[model samples]
Target: MLKIQEIREIIKLIDQSSINEFTFEQDGSKIKMKKQSQEVETVVRNVVAAPPVEVVSTQPQPVPTQQPVQEASAPKTEETKADTSNLHKITSPMVGTFYAASSPEAGNYVSVGSKVTNDTVVCIVEAMKLFNEIEAEVKGEIVEILAENGQLVEYGQPLFLVKPE
Candidate 1:
């Protein structure tokens, strides 16, 4: 049987690494940990003729769950350090992979100097295998692209900077 402390330590190590899954087995006990949506899900099993059970630990609380991408908080960056009072930031509504274009062969949703209205589809953020079209809620001209294509963006992370119209 694995001790709670040992399990917690293993979780800590896995949490710090980028590996999505980790598994261990010895004797008749087995443990599997998988990461999903930034939170770790653990499954324990026993090969012996015994009922499998779940062990809960309070040391490492799961991070708050995130909702689907939508407009979120915009953090200040180097570009914002400049006099950007007249600028508007297009922030990610959820955590996902940011894509500048709809597909490899398609044109980017928006580019620097591109004029956009409040309803313009500025980019697509892929979350949970679903492509979410992100809209520019404010009229502006694209001034900068803060996130790279195929980059993992966090909730409220600035994806673009625009000079307000």
Candidate 2:
């Protein structure tokens, strides 16, 4: 791990250099420092689950057959809100990963057309290893779930659209 003094030195070096950003990675720790117009931004993330790399292969290999699933729903969610402005939206209060259930094996807290009270927990948002239960403050039936399961949601991003009864 890099020391605080080392980080300070790096920041000082970045300030002196012509480069606007600096990034370094060692083992599983990654650090990114960027200079914005108003301030300096620093982001850090640790990824610890990598297998050991020992052998080098010279032969050409075929690409993996499994395809990645990308969620193309953010724009559609915006369109949905625009189309139905009468509905009440349950937006996220913080940036986190949206989860429909408490656990992977559990049922979703709320689904489309599901009746909900003001105190109902409609979803869970996990931020920095903490799971936060999100509530539906409006008394209504859930009309649409704007975010997909396990999707990353930003602050004020709509999670559910509800139609008041």
Candidate 2 wrong stretches, greater than 4 Å: 2-30, 34-83
Task: Give the alpha carbon lDDT tens digit for every residue of 49-72 in model 2.
Answer: 765333221222233343334345
Q: What's the lDDT for candidate 2?
A: 0.77
CA-lDDT, candidates in order: 0.82, 0.77
Q: What would the TM-scores of all predictions be? A: 0.57, 0.56
Model 1, which residues run further than 4 Å from truth?
A: 1-80
Residue pairs in collision within model 2: none
**Global CA lDDT of candidate 1, please?**
0.82
In the predicted model 1, the residue pairs found to clash are: 69-93, 69-94, 70-93
